[model samples]
Structures are given as structure tokens and as C-alpha cells.
Target: MSLAPSGFLNLGAQNLEYRMIGPVPEHAPTIVMLHEGLGSAALWGDFPDRLQAATGAGVFVYSRAGYGASTAVKLPRPLDYMHVEALEVLPKLLEWIDFRRGLLVGHSDGASIAAIYAGGVQDHRVLGLALIAPHFIVEDVSVASIAAIKTAYETTDLRSKLARWHKDIDTAFYGWNGAWLDPKFRNWDISEYLTYIRVPVAILQGVNDEYGTIRQVEIAREECYCPVDVMEIANAGHSPHREAPETTLDAISEFANAVLRDEGFRAA
Candidate 1:
């Protein structure tokens, strides 16, 4: 099916809200962006547009189930939700978009999903990965941060603020929060998938990130046999793309250009 520049993609299970920037995937390499746990297509703001301009590639940003205008998911999400997204939902989304060749650029939960997809799917069309604030394993700091956010959502205006971005705010917030806060989730780890990945990987992390620490990066270095490039953005928190747009964009653009060079792709 032909994807319009911006619309909801009917993927049978659910309809995902999405936006397409620059050329279509058939005309240029695509950059499929996955949002953080609480993030959505609109939450990406103008980053997709900027990324397309910088890389001269198609930028596809989408709101997964229960976020933005997408279908709302059942509450108390499975601890393996990211894996489900990576393995089930994503493959369909990419095929629906007619993705040819591209990189998977994901942030936080999105980043973890990207990693799982690259490692587990063995899809040669996916050339590389750009992971931002990815979590390979559950960390104490991550649990702490997630628990604190649950409190903030209850007591502060964080809920109202996030509501502006998500259509089913409660589902979007609780689905992610509940899963991470679950004690059983502590054993959740995807590092095993790293050893299977065949493409280059770039990790852009915030030095002051509160959700995760440098250990996440260390895991990638330790597990992946492929090239792993890391850039720690100082003074930034979890979301470096929003916190440090220029540096993040330049870094990702450079990575994409280098990876796609064999395909005659260049990012100015």
C-alpha cells in the first residue's frame, strides 16, 4: 500500500500513527525511528524532518500501540513488550512502508527495540543501528527513575504534560511504567541478542542520563562483534536528541552516511 506523507497505517492488529519525511523508502535509504517508552511520533517533533535533511534519507516516525493516536494497548503490559514490538510489530511496519535499505534509529525503549530487531530478525535490509539511551538490562537506577516518574505522574503535572503527546495518556504511561516497575522485570535482559547482530551500531548517550548509566554502552562493546561507535553528550539527560539536537543529529547523520556509503548515499 502507498503510504501518504502523514497518516495512520493499518497494520491489521492496530493502526499506527506515522509521518514520512523527505523521499520515500524506494527513492532513498530510510531511517526508521522508534520512540522512547513514553514517546510517540509527535513527541519526535521536528527531529525526523531535520534528520531527513541532514542525511538525505527518508525518515519514518511512528507511534506504537497505546501512544499518540495509535490503538490503545491492554493495561499492565507484558514485561516483554519491547521484544514483542521488535519481533512482531516492527517487521510488519517496515514491510508496510516498503522499506528497502535503511538504519534503525531508536531512543530508550525504542532503542532497545531496534537492537532486538537488528539482532533477532536477521534482516539484511537493515544496515545499521543508532541507539539512544538503550537498556540492555534492567538497572537499579532505571527502576528508581521509573518509580519516581510514577510518583510524579500521580502528584505532579507530568501526566497532563504527557497527555498532550499521547491520546490514551493513562495507557501510555501505565503500560510502560507498570512493566518496568514489576519485580519480575529485573531479570529482563536483551544483551544476548547483541552477539547475533551483524551490522554496525552507534550509541549516543547522555552523560548525565538519569534512567541508565555507562554500563549500557559497555554491554554493547562487550557483546557485539560488529563495529560499535559511542558518543556521550555531556550535560544532557536521557533524551540527547532533544537535549542536544545539533550534536545528536550530526553524529547520527555521519553514522548513516558512513554506513550507507556503499549504496551511494551521502549526508551533507
Candidate 2:
């Protein structure tokens, strides 16, 4: 466990604790794992370790503001939290971590952030990308499933399960669910930005994903001009890495190896 000294990261007017794993000074490319909407670094469990072991790449996993070990926002999150995440917060995180290039393995909302970040880059450090159950635009299935999740949160044992992972589950849940469910959010799309990515990409989408459609990954591939290999894991849910860890990590291992090979740095 090569976890870094966890500490607060000052990002503009906000601060959140960031955790790092693996070797320092970047002897190898890092794969940053961005958590799901309601997820924190703690929720990632052992996936990061598996990825590190397989790829020999140090992993950076952190909870964003208002989730996990990070501090909650003093005020209400704006309706466009995705934009806030992509434009304002993520860049600061990259700078704070002292990395110039690497892979981004994002889940759910974190995937969206990675897309936007890579798309926005000039001389970007992103060597490759892996999006797990990412969403570029909301799909009806997503809206429906999220609505159902909300129902489960109130009426079933889901909240208790979530509470075990999140100290303020409401902050984590509402911050993600409310913004996506909001009608105005339907118009959101990052298709235009994906074209800017020069790195290879791998998109993992479940055929039965709870909150998205296959077309989302298709559009990302098309717009980015890189046909990222899409793996539609049969019977997998929105969290394929959780549902099918071995399958998910196998794809990730392939991408990381390819990237390192392209850069002439074989995995040790």
C-alpha cells in the first residue's frame, strides 16, 4: 500500500483531500480513477490495487468535493455540476497532482470529466483513456434507473448501504441525482470536445447498463475520431468493474500495456 500522505488540495475556493498510490516522481504513467457520481475513493475497494499490480502503473484515486473524505461545499451546488466538475475542479486536481500526462479511468460522472479534460487539452498528457459506464448525454434508461434508485433510497435498504460508504450520503446522492434529473440538464453534451483527444481510448459499457446507452460511447468514439474498443459486457450493470472485476481489469490491462508500449516503456 503505497498510499500518499492524504491532505487537502486547494482548488480555487474549494479544497478536497486527494489520495495517491504506487511509485512517485512518475517513473511510469499514472492511471487516475475517477469515482462514480455517488462514489468515493474508499468505495473503489481493491480495483486500484489490481490495476496497479497488472499494469505496474501507480494509481491516483481521490474523492471530489462533497463526497468521501473531501469537504462538502458551503453552498448549494449549481445546477450544472458536470460543467463545474469539468471546467473548474478537474484541472486544479491535475496540477495539484504534479502530472503532465497519463491515462484516465473514469466511472460514470468521472468518465465525463476525463472526456472533457482530454478534449480540452493543448499538448495534453493523456496517453490513453478508459471510460467505464460513461455518459455523454442522458438516456431515458438512465433517467428511469436513477429515478428508481431514488425510490429505493427512500423506501428500501439502499440508503443504509450507501451510508456505510458515504458520511453524507445525501450530499453525494443529491449532488449527482438532482442535477442529472433536472430538465435543463437534458441539453448537456460534450460531443464537440471529444474531437480534441489524441490518445487511444477504450470504452467499457454494459449492454444492460442501468443509467446509459451504447450510443453514448459510440458518439464519443466518433467525435474523438478514435474508435475506442467498446466492450458490452453481457448482463453487466452500470458498475461493470464491480459486477465483473476480472473482465473489466483485463481490458484495462490491455489499454495500459498498449499505451506504455507506444511510449516505449514496457511494464516492469
Candidate 3:
């Protein structure tokens, strides 16, 4: 319920700010929850703990650079942050935290990262993956929502509220929003990589999601070679886990429990 004192994780060339929740249990593999673009350790809210309580697996949640309290990402982020998170940052994070194997619950940008990592990385540490309202392709809804968010932040209290959770709200917002809106970002595609993922993956998308449509999840389901499950939560938006944590957690728990069964791990 409370955040512990902030700690510094040495990311080779630089230090990244990170925090922890619990060692949870080993019933299923660990569930590493990746936050949205605007999300941080604190922004993950109470969902991780609730999920751990339900599934009895350790939960790892942290902020990516330029979000939450992590170090600033100095370079101009290529349109595919999912690739960067998958190839560069996540591997280092696993090594930094010594996370050997687990399930991943990623939302929004985090979901894209989870997908990329599950598919591209040669490491088989991931047993399963659950993506909440994930986006593999850019759509009009995504651009519209982002533009609306931009307008609101410039005119409303959204920026101040976000600042309470992020040290540099402006930087985080711009870094994420600006890149996604760029013309070159439209060509971003990770479907080629998705075909390589062999683990069980559950894709959860809000039917009314403002950022993505069913087409995205449909594409993922059709292309992914892994065991793919789809759950379309009705009447929700981009932050499916935040807006409806219980349903999202239940779907994630079921997928992880199934994986545990496959591996003969005791979930009961």
C-alpha cells in the first residue's frame, strides 16, 4: 500500500530509479507488470498487489526511463520504443534484478513491450504473456486520443495530476506523446517478431478502447504462433487494468495458472 524509499538501479552506463512491492510466491512464474508510457512504479497503483494476492506469484513493477522516477532517456526515441524496451532495457532489467522466468502483464505501451520481448528475445525466461489493451498498430483512435490528451494537458489539470506521480511530467508526456504522433512512427510493425514467440499469451483489449481497436488484437491473434487467448473486456479504455483491475487480474491469473499447470507447478 505504501511505496518504500526509492532505490537506484545501476543500468551499466547510468542509474535508473526503481522500487519493489514483494517477493510474492512461486505458484506460477513471476508476473512482471510493465506500466504504460505515462506510468511509473507508483502509477501501477494497487493492481500488482491485488494480482499477487490472487495468483500467489511474485510481481515485479518498475518505471522505464523518462517515466516515473527512472533516469531520463536522453536519445531521441525511435518510433518503436517497444523494440528498445524488449531488446535493450528489459534484458538489462532482468539481469539487474536477476529475474529468471515469469509471466508478463503489460498495458498499453507496456503491452507492446511485453509482446516484443516475448517474441524477439532469445531468452526463454518468459513462460507466458498477458497484454491489456495492447497496440501493435497505430490507428485513428490512437492518434485522436493522444491529441486529446495533449490538448487536455495543455489546458486542464491533467498535467498537474500526472506531475504528482512523475518528477518531470512534461518530459514524460512529450517524450511519449511526441514520438507516437510523428509521421515515421506509422510504419512501426512488430508482427514479424510475434511469429517467433512460442509461449502462452493472453491478449486483453477493451472493446471501447480509445487508443486501439479489435483489429490490433485480431492481427496479433492471427499472426502469433504462440498459444494465444483473447478477452475483449466491454466498456473500457486504454487503462483496462486501472479502470477494471479485477477483470484484468482474473484473466491474467487464469493464463498464468494454466501455464503453471503445463509446467506441473502447484497453483493450489
Top lDDT hit: 1
**Per-model lDDT:** 0.94, 0.80, 0.79
Clash count, one per candidate = 0, 1, 0
Q: Using TM-score, rank the candidates from best to worst.
A: 1, 2, 3
lDDT of 2 by residue, 1-268 (tens): 2336566677776667666777642566778889899999889989998898888777888888888868776335676676678777777777777775578899998998888878876436778889999888778888898888889988999888998877688888887778777888778887787888777889998888878888897788678776577888887889999999999999988888888788776666
**Lowest-scoring 10 consecutive residues by lDDT in candidate 1?**
259-268
Looking at model 2, report the run of 10 residues with the lowest lDDT sum. Answer: 1-10
lDDT of 1 by residue, 1-268 (tens): 5568999999897999999988898888999999999999999989889889888889999999999999988988998999999999999999999999999999999999999999999899999999999999999999999999999999999999999999889999999999999999999999999999999999999999999999999999999999999999997899999999999999998899888897788754
Instruction: Order the candidate numbers by lDDT, best to worst.
Output: 1, 2, 3
User: Judged by TM-score, which candidate is best?
Assistant: 1
Clashes of 3: 0
lDDT of 1 at 65: 94
TM-score of each: 0.98, 0.93, 0.92
TM-score of 2: 0.93
Q: List the residue pairs that clash in candidate 1.
A: none
